[model samples]
Target: MESSAAKYCCDNINNHGSSSQSQTSTCMQKFRLYETRSNFYMIGRDKSRTYWRVLKIDRLDPSELNIREDSTTYTESECSELLRRIHEGNISTGGLRFVTICYGIVGFIKFLGPYYMLLITKRRQIGSIRGHNVYAVSKTEMIPVPNATVNSSIADSKDENRYKKLLCTVDLTKDFFFSYSYHVMLSLQKNLCNNEPGQFLYETMFVWNEFLTRGIRGHLQNTLWTVALVYGFFKQATLSVSGRDFKLTLIARRSRHYAGTR
Candidate 1:
């Protein structure tokens, strides 16, 4: 069904009536809050190693939302148009629903609305942080969160210098680190107290940048709510009575002080 909100956008575009930005979103409430509320979409998966997704900010329409269930599948390029139209859309109706859905954001460098994001692609156990196994970044990928309208590769002759310079600054195979469920940043004492059954926070405020962490304060946070902090790729595993092709991802949550495996 065509939502009243989306319908209004088409109407407002045709009429060009002066409408307040807040009022426009209020009119879009039905479609925006439900279908387009998610921060990302699982576009597709291939074998066990490759996966794809599109940030919500890149989407053109809320009705296009496709969340892969155990039985669903997608292609890597399925959402490329969404990425392409990000720069093409007209905002005459009102402010566009764009947010860089990212977390664990580091670096002081800012590009307009979003900060550059780093994802750990490969990891190797280097040592222990307070008895917790800390893995070093063996591989990584740099992804610009917002629509930067520029290529990251040096292949573009016009942007070769600019892209090359930015690309040269990162070497993901070193220094970066991560541990799935371990609070490697905090000490064992504090972490132990954190997981004492009821004290663990659903959201960690400090991990978020000052701009976003403020509003989310004193509220329950979940991995789903902070999908931007997620690592490399999100895979969709689908299953059916006929057959199960989706690979199972096992996330083991251990108690404090008890180190878990990958």
Candidate 2:
């Protein structure tokens, strides 16, 4: 059943009012990670930081990604109070501690050991189109889901380290770019002409993190907590034609479907 808020949003859109625009406009862009002994709590906030939500990731399982999003929306004060209570309750067990701040989740990958969550820890604004900011990965982090004691033998294996090293060899900061509010994977024409929802677009070939985000997206039924990253090339430059200067931009999107095929 659609909640009153969702129904109101649809009604507002049907009337063509300015009350609600693209869903991307409301997607969470900033996140803070907190960790206890058995779980990782990720707090996400919107652009204004007015709306808040929490996602809980279980740390007890080394082989599976168990993610659950809290259904309640929270205000700044209420969220602080909730976190305070959580800390108080877990004080005897080395209470919740700040892990790291991240722009968005890259995805999760598993090796011979436990699953590692890839995160875009740092980003740089490379360019923009139609007022939407596009960012390139400046730095990334891969954190093991389970503690070291859980998978001691597998985590320290030579194959696991080799696989992890191979994954890190592909430099993400070079050509990859993503937008928080724009469908950077699709062309401008498709973006303007098509009215498809953001969640559907995420399943398309251009999004490199499609496979990685599938579990979380399926669990939450929304793409609000993840950013769709386009793996390809983006370049912007200035051109001079006869005495006039114009901005030129180029974007090349790699097709995941035909990537490894002959």
Candidate 3:
């Protein structure tokens, strides 16, 4: 791919602008989560902080995932004012409370009762390939969409706790990394030469969050709210060979198809 095209796609992850005729960047890199009694308002912005968008998650229903994306793109000040309005409108039942700042949505999952949202709360840069930064998950959070009062009975069940524990054992912070701009799962040659649809990238075998992100991606028809994490290994090192210095980078991607046999 051309450097200019890559940069344009990276900087404008959602491919939308503030106006119908003018095209501006809305990367959706950083997110601020706010919540009222019945809903979650996720505000996302680009790295430059010039463009912004909103995602609404309904918290009233435990059995289903309800997510809606606001079609308009806002300026920083306008986005803040919109948030203020939401806060003031919901002031009767504790107002809109600040939840947490997250880098990207890992995905949404559920057990027997309510659904839970997985968020990447912290990330650390590991390396970069062709000007695209790659990061490993430093910290993560799995928060139930519905409050404790809504799913009190099922939330406290033994089976539910056990399932949660089982999921935690995977330890996402260990050997997973992703890039908001680059398609890490694809080989370097393919990434450079192929101009595949964004949806095809997510549907590949290497993306660990494929199934988890399907619901929201299907609903909004875009991937502005999540990141596709790749599980396996990554390492970079410098070495001396024949009295000359050399650099080596290794990436190992785990295959989900034949995971347990060998």
Number of the top lDDT candidate: 3
TM-score of each: 0.33, 0.85, 0.86
**Mind sharing the TM-score for model 2?**
0.85
lDDT of each: 0.32, 0.78, 0.78
Best-fitting candidate, measured by TM-score? 3
Range of the 10 consecutive residues with the lowest summed lDDT in candidate 3: 1-10
lDDT of 1 by residue, 21-110 (tens): 222111100001112321222222222423332212222322222121111112445334443333233323332343322222222223
Better by TM-score, candidate 2 or 1 = 2
Q: Pick out the ten consecutive residues of candidate 1 with the lowest summed lDDT.
A: 25-34
Candidate 2 — what's its lDDT? 0.78
lDDT of 3 by residue, 109-165 (tens): 889889999999999998877778889999999989986656758777999999999
- Candidate 2 segments exceeding 4 Å error: 1-25, 238-246, 260-262
Candidate 3: C-alpha lDDT: 0.78
